[model samples]
Target: MNILILANQDLASNLALNLLLPSLQRHTLRVFLSSRVGKPGALPELKRLRFFEQSLCNEMLFPHLPEPGQRDAQYLSFSQFTPLLTSPVEIVNTINSDESLSRVSALKPDLILSIRYGGILKDPLLAIPKQGVINLHSGLLPDYRGVMATFWAMLNGEREIGTTCHFIEDDSIDTGGVISACRLTVHSERSYLWHVLQLYTGGCELLLDAVERIAYGEKPVARPQSTKGGYFSFPQAEDFTAFSQKGLKLVDEEEMLEFFKHYYY
Candidate 1:
């Protein structure tokens, strides 16, 4: 099966690539890079991206990797994936643009996969793929829908935060039917970034499962997302205060380094 991926260039995207790309030897993979790839937008995003690259450099790649240091391979060998991280994928700036949509249609992909591509796909693009578009949403559907869901989960002081893989539908934020979901317990002791990474790392496995099921002509269960409103946007100041009160650090460098050690090693 030929799978087309639409993704940005952030830790989530990078982590997704680390897991998804190498595991796809059974299928054809082509990537449609999000226009925002490699470009930092807002301040919070900028800071986290910087931290992810610099702090996690020992375990992953960076635009500029630091001076050489002897270290055993963590989880996956970062050296082997240099090609995927450095090489450019075809950029699809607007998923709705006629030219972009036409270009995508020309690919004739069997499946279209999206991981925080930062753009809404129109009906034309949706209909192009034989299997329809699958989105790896940052949060669980019908409940934690929208941006910063993992953060929201932490902010709400919930015990579980997770990633959801769903079938994309027309004209909604994350109204897609659920394909699969995996939840990680919110260890408030863990860094906020560590929790966020679960959305990418664990999420991709769910995505791969959905892909295999669809490829085999098996109908994976698609639970309809709830109509009741629980949509969320970026967090407000008070939310951060709540998060602080819950003893969740905005960024915990050492905790995440240990997290990488345990996850990757």
Candidate 2:
């Protein structure tokens, strides 16, 4: 299977480390990345920065992930992997550009996988893939639609959060029928960042499973979604205050004890 991957900095590294590298063993994989340049943010600059700081702080709340030295960096963006990130990948600032479309046509991919990629897919590019373009979204279907989904899930004090892989029917965000999805247990004790990590780790497996099924001529049935859940954007300061007041934690007592035993003692 020839697969074309579309990703950006955040989830790009996640896809590469979890899915793309493994997929290369069997399929001919190529990547189209949106240069981490001027992507539009839903919030003001100050809010975006605040969210970023909060995200890093959230990471500290979790148990150490046992990444040795440079391996820790691999958990970051493409640059962390360096040469091995050296797949037959192309970087495109804009995915809908004529050049980008020409490149997509050139690859003649069997399937397209999108992960946190911002660029819109249109017309010929959308029509080119044999199996179809599949998006690995961070939120569960019709309920948790739109951007920063896992954050919203935890913010709402919901206990269940998960990943969704849907066949791209149109240009809408996460609206297509679900092909595959896996739910994770989200304890109220856990922070939104923890849920994000859950998606990063579990999401890829679901994607690979879906793609493998596609390879075996098992086209996933499209489960049309309802428009019940409203869309979301970036979080505001008030939202962050709520998140903090809820005492949302990324790691609980037992996990912290385990971290100490493993790393310190």
Candidate 3:
């Protein structure tokens, strides 16, 4: 099947692409990375994009992986078998205007996979694929829908955090058909960054499952999300601080060191 991936350049989206792209050999895949690059002095841009990067970077989720080797390994493991992707992967610094949605349409993809593309996909654009578009969200749909669902789940002290692969409807947000979901328990001692990376890794598997099921002409499942349990956006600074203070249950430093060594080595 021919697949087109719509994604951004941030860690989450980039990691998703890194894993997903190499797996494209199984299906004909084309990737278009929506660039998050900005002008040096762009006022609102720095506040919105750079600030989030800095804040999340400092939070220490995956351990300061400044070294390319460490970062590559973390991304590759999540990719599983996708690293075999031999198809063309194009990085577009901006998909807002100059992006030829037409060129993407020309690919005539059997399916489109959207993972945090960071922009609204209009009908004229989403209509290109022969099969419908789908998204793998960080939160389990019908409950937590929107940006930072993983973080929001952590803040809420939810026992489980997971991924939702859903069909794309005409709506702007998460109002869509359910495809499939995968969830895992959040360890009290784990940092929010750790929790999110786990979710990110798990999401790749769930997404692959959803793709295979749909490719086989099967109806995965579609359930309406409860209006009562609605959307939540990113948390504010004060809220984050409060959650940080209470969310993590302390583990002995030696135990933590041993655990890190076991995983890192």
Candidate 4:
């Protein structure tokens, strides 16, 4: 099968790719990584969120990833893995634009997979693939929808967090029918970043399973979302305060470093 993957260019998304892409070697794959560039006049909170996210990626994640023309057996870096891909990855912000649509149409993808992709897929783009687009959302749907879902789940004092694999039936965010969902225990001692990173392991497995099922000429079952789950945007300052009050953190450097040691290296 020819698979086109739309994913975010971020630490967590990259980690997901690391887990997923290798297994997809059997299929023809094209990847487009969406940038996380902030919009003009973005809120300070959004800017701060982006800053911390980029800092973690720059300071810790990227350094461990392989450099151009370099491959280290000790660790699998984004640079190292990408070069192994049959097609060169495209980085684009204008995913739904005319040019992008043309480019994607030319590929003639049998299936489209989205993981933390920033852009919304319009009807034209959604119509391009034969099997249609499936997204691996970082949160379970109907209950948690939209950005920073794990944060919202934690802030709401949920003991478990989840990831959902669902069909992208339209332009709405995370409202698609569910193919599968996986849950993980929320460890109070772990950083929010840690939990987010951990989700991809199970998430990617679900995605891979979906792909395999599709390849075998089986349509993966999808259940429509029955309830209207609350949608969450980036947290406000007061929300962060509440998170802290609950003894949770956005990032824990030491814990992340230790995790990286075993997981990445």
Q: Highest TM-score, which number? A: 4
> For candidate 2, lDDT tens digit of each residue in 1-265?
8888887644324433544565555777666666442333554543444344233223442234443352432332343333443364456877777887787788788999888776666766788898999998888888887777777888897788888888887877678888878889887765454456556667888778888888999987878888787688666778867776888753344543332242222
**Model 3 worst lDDT run, 10 consecutive residues:** 74-83
Extract clashing residue pairs from model 4.
65-77, 66-77
What order do you get sorting by TM-score, best first? 4, 1, 2, 3
Off by over 4 Å in 4: 37-52, 55-75, 262-264
Two-way TM-score contest, 2 vs 3, winner: 2
lDDT of 4 by residue, 8-80 (tens): 7777777888888888999988888887632423556556556555566756667666554354333354555
Residue-by-residue lDDT tens digits, candidate 1, 101-179: 8777887888989987867777888888888889998786778887777787787778888888999878578898888
- Best candidate according to lDDT: 4
* Per-model TM-score on C-alpha atoms: 0.81, 0.76, 0.73, 0.90
lDDT of 2: 0.66
Across 9-123, the per-residue lDDT of candidate 3 in tens digits comes to 4556656765566555678776666654323244353354344343343235344544434543434322222334435456654443535766766667888898877666667
How does candidate 4 fare on TM-score? 0.90
* lDDT for predicted candidate 1 compared with the true structure: 0.72
lDDT of all predictions, in order shown? 0.72, 0.66, 0.64, 0.82
Alpha carbon lDDT at 159, candidate 4 = 90
